[model samples]
Target: MDPEALNPVIDKAVESGIPVVMFDADAPNSKAYAFLGTNNYYAGVTAADKMAELLNEAGGEVGVVTHPNQLNHKERTEGFRETIEKEYPKMTVVDVKDGRGDQMISKEVSEELMREYPNIKGIFASEANGGVGVGKAVIDQQKKGGDIHIISFDTDKGTLDMINDGIISATMAQGTWKMGYWSLQFLFHLQHDIAGELEGETNLPRYVDTGITVVTKDNVNEYYPGE
Candidate 1:
């Protein structure tokens, strides 16, 4: 199951001995056997480094927003925060809002942040929905889109448009297809001994590093919808 978005639901299933495999995000505490997803922390770290490279001199205030209390969001934010603080102390993270994966709510939160932090020069979003939501908010304000330098996650429809239109800066594309594919594969292997599992390999790889790539205006066509 795609536990990245909903940990508790998957955790519950895992506790009940249901063959659950995670994706995109993880559930370490849950008894789930295996996880098939990206190293979200590293993804966050890479995003921060890219932002620093893109806006080294234009640093003012950066913000990160995500769905309220999501596991993947939490990990992404943690990585982003840790990397930014450790490497680019000049850039500061000002406000963090919970968009709840809702467009209206994300819009409202982004608008409020803009009003509150006029110096917000850049933004990093932890998920596809939050990225598009913040992008829409910035566009509605008629602000200089390129100047904000947004870095987002996933490849949703709105996010793709924002990247293409230069409303957002870049996005980290995750192996979502792998998330689905491996989750099922691992579950099947666990159920059947066709492969004859090795001894001493009791637990699954505590963490699986799926993979990620940065999508930007320069190479946006490489990730056009349906491509």
Candidate 2:
């Protein structure tokens, strides 16, 4: 997600009086009417806490694989990195790799990260493919036994498979359905003023936090919506 490219478009849409609502990922610099999605930074904080638990509170070096260009991914990684540094005295984010949200690329980066940080206790993959790729890299290098804890994002099938197979420890599940459902509602509200006029405009929150669910092996099946 190139904010440089997308921001201009969003600004144009707003100028043309088209109410633009951003979902999941946002172009923050643009005049987007509102954003409806998870509070990604807090979600990252959640992942870090989970990782701390997985490492038995004896934190160590951690690596990150993420797409830094996107707003949401950046927020997730920042949240995770900051929490590790501020809350966990023993842990540090030693390195970061640009996974670009590609499975193969992420896998390659994960393998490289492990080689560089052999004693890396935790890895936070801030995207779904990156998580699956990190899980595969861990399994391939024989590092899955809680020695290298992993916290990944999203509830995709690949991430779920990683959790079920004990390759990935846990992942953040975004309220995707709510993001979609509310984005439309926000758009409609922008045009129709459904919430009723306040002052000179309709009343609507600029940001709507759909929230996240941490999915682990114990609750993976129950959270998976389908059998």
Candidate 3:
């Protein structure tokens, strides 16, 4: 969706005394009350660190699969790339390709990437579908749980399963429940003028870092539902 298109709607909602908060994806230019979601850039940095560790600091070529134009994905990709370049000098980003947030497309693109850059040692998947797709590509190529490591985003069931099977090395898990709960709290505060109770502060924080965790085989069982 066009960020510009959202500006008018967000402005109208604010003008009508309705509170708006964006999560997962953001429109920084919008007049929403706040953004409550993962610190996508930092999550990307986390992925970089995990990927480096999985490669045992002996860095090699890595590829990225992500939504190319979305704001959150863009930030994540940027963070991963920048961190790799600055801190892991031995690692290089061989290519970045759009996954379109679809499993099949991601798999196809990942397969192409693997074929093109056979020396690629790792891949950072910026979303769940992309992560699973990358895993499938690796498996199809008979490289699953082998030299190519994968660091992915989110803890969807498929991603977790892949991690369990050693097809994916790790994943960045977001605080999804916190995003929902805090978004409501912020909206309630705005609607009820709760901030007026504060001595000096009258505005909610513009951005909230919902936080992220690296999920790996050692703790993968903990992330399962009800575990």
**Whole-model lDDT per candidate:** 0.77, 0.86, 0.89
Error of 2 at 142 (Å): 1.6
TM-score, candidate 2, is: 0.91
lDDT, residue 14, model 1? 61
Q: Give the number of the best model, judged by TM-score.
A: 3
Write one digit per residue (lDDT tens) for candidate 1, span 133-164. 88888887765433467888888778888998
Each prediction's TM-score against the native? Answer: 0.84, 0.91, 0.94
Lowest-scoring 10 consecutive residues by lDDT in candidate 3? 195-204
The alpha-carbon lDDT assigned to residue 74 of candidate 3 equals 88
In candidate 2, what are the lDDT values of residues 1-227, reduced to their tens digit? 76557888888988898888889877777888778889989999999899899988887899999998787788898999999889998988999899988888998998898888888887899989999888878888774443577899988888998899888999999999999999998888787757576785547887889999989999899766575
Candidates arranged by lDDT, highest first: 3, 2, 1
Candidate 3 residues 1-227, lDDT tens each? 35556889998998897878887677889888789998888999999998899999998999999998887898899999999999999999999999999999999999989989988899999999999999999997764434688999899999999999989999999999999999889888888888564454447888899999999999999999999
- Residues forming the 10-long window of minimal summed lDDT in candidate 2: 140-149
Q: After superposition, how far is residue 216 of candidate 2 from its true place, in Å?
A: 0.2
Q: By lDDT, is 2 or 3 better?
A: 3
